[model samples]
Target: MALRITDECINCDVCEPQCPNTAISMGPEHYIIDPDRCTECVGHFDEPQCQVFCPVECIEVDPDHTEDRETLEAKFRRLAVS
Candidate 1:
């Protein structure tokens, strides 16, 4: 599943750089994750790099944009090529 940054974010700015897909970006209030670009680091790492490096632990699975591992992997492949 894609991951999302919640309101609990402290804006420490650690999560943005960790996203391999460049899915995380500055939102109006805090950081936001684009579901289209998010693959939970499927092809890049065992776990989502953003989630792993997030100091506030505000990152979590996006229930509104659910996806399976295979789907994430496919997205990763597409992203890698482009």
Candidate 2:
């Protein structure tokens, strides 16, 4: 599943650079994750880098944009070639 930044985010700017797919971006109020570009780091790492580095633990799976591991891996591959 794709991850999302919650309102609990402190806007620390730590999670943005950690995303392998470059899915995290600064939104109007806080950081936001693009579900289209998010792959949960399946192809890049064993775990999600953003979540690992996030100090406040505000990143969580996006329930509304849920996806399986295989789908995330496919997305990662697509991102790699593009």
Candidate 3:
């Protein structure tokens, strides 16, 4: 599944750059994750780099954009080609 930055995010500028897919960006309030580009770091890393680097622990799975591992892998593959 893709991830979302909750309102709890402190805007510490920690998770944005950690995203391999460039899915994370500064939103009006805090960092937001684009589900279209998010693969939970499936093809890029063993774990989600954004989650790894986020100190506030505000990032969480996006319930509104849930996806399976295989789907994430496919997205990752597609992203790699572009």
Candidate 4:
């Protein structure tokens, strides 16, 4: 599943740089995760880097954009080629 930034985000600026896919960006209020680019760090790490680094634990799985590991891996591979 892709991850999302919640309103609880403190705008700590930690999550943006941690995203290997460059999916996190500053939104109107807090950081937002682009589902199209989010791979949950599958191609880069065993765990999601942004969630690990978010100080407030505001990052969570996006229920509306859920994807299995295989799908995430495919997306990661596609991203790698581009």
Candidate 5:
């Protein structure tokens, strides 16, 4: 599933550059992830880099935009192709 940053985020900017899919972006309130672009690093890394780098542990699976691993991989593949 795609990951999202919560309001608890400290805005430390630690997770931004760590996202393999470049899905994380600065938001009006907190760092945000584009679900369409996020693959939880399935096609890029062994784990979610954002979650790893976030010192506040505010990154979590996006419940509102839940997706299976296969779907995430498909999205990754599509992004790679284009």
Candidate 6:
């Protein structure tokens, strides 16, 4: 699943640099994650990098964008190949 920054986000910019896929970006209100680029850190890390670094715990899985492990892996693979 892709993570979404909550309104609780402080816009600290801490999470931006932590994303290996460059999925996270600045928003007018808060940081945003591009779902097309988000692999939940599967291709690059053992865990979600953004979740680990978000100071306010604002990063959480988007239930609406949920995907199985295989799908997530495939998504990462596609990104890698591209």
lDDT tens digits by residue: candidate 3, 34-67: 9999999998899999989888889899999999
Ranking by TM-score: 4, 2, 3, 1, 6, 5
Alpha-carbon lDDT of model 1: 0.91
lDDT of 5 by residue, 1-82 (tens): 7888889998898988988778888899888999989999998988999888788899999888889889988999998987
Cα-based lDDT for every prediction: 0.91, 0.93, 0.92, 0.95, 0.88, 0.89
Candidate 4 minimal-lDDT segment of 10 residues: 51-60
* Candidate 1 C-alpha lDDT tens digits along 1-82: 8889999998898988888999999999999999999999888888888888888899999899999888998999999999
Question: lDDT tens digits, residues 13-71, model 6?
Answer: 89999998899998888889998889999979999989998878999999879888899
Best by lDDT: 4
**Per-residue lDDT of 7 in model 1:** 98
RMSD of 1: 0.7
Give the best candidate by TM-score.
Answer: 4
Candidate 4 wrong stretches, greater than 4 Å: none
Backbone clashes (count) for model 4 = 0
Greater TM-score among 1 and 2 belongs to: 2
- For each candidate, give its TM-score against the true structure: 0.96, 0.97, 0.96, 0.98, 0.93, 0.94
The count of backbone overlaps in candidate 2 is 0
How far in Å is the alpha carbon of 14 misplaced in model 5? 1.0
Model 5 gets an lDDT of: 0.88
Worst 10 residues of 3 by lDDT: 13-22
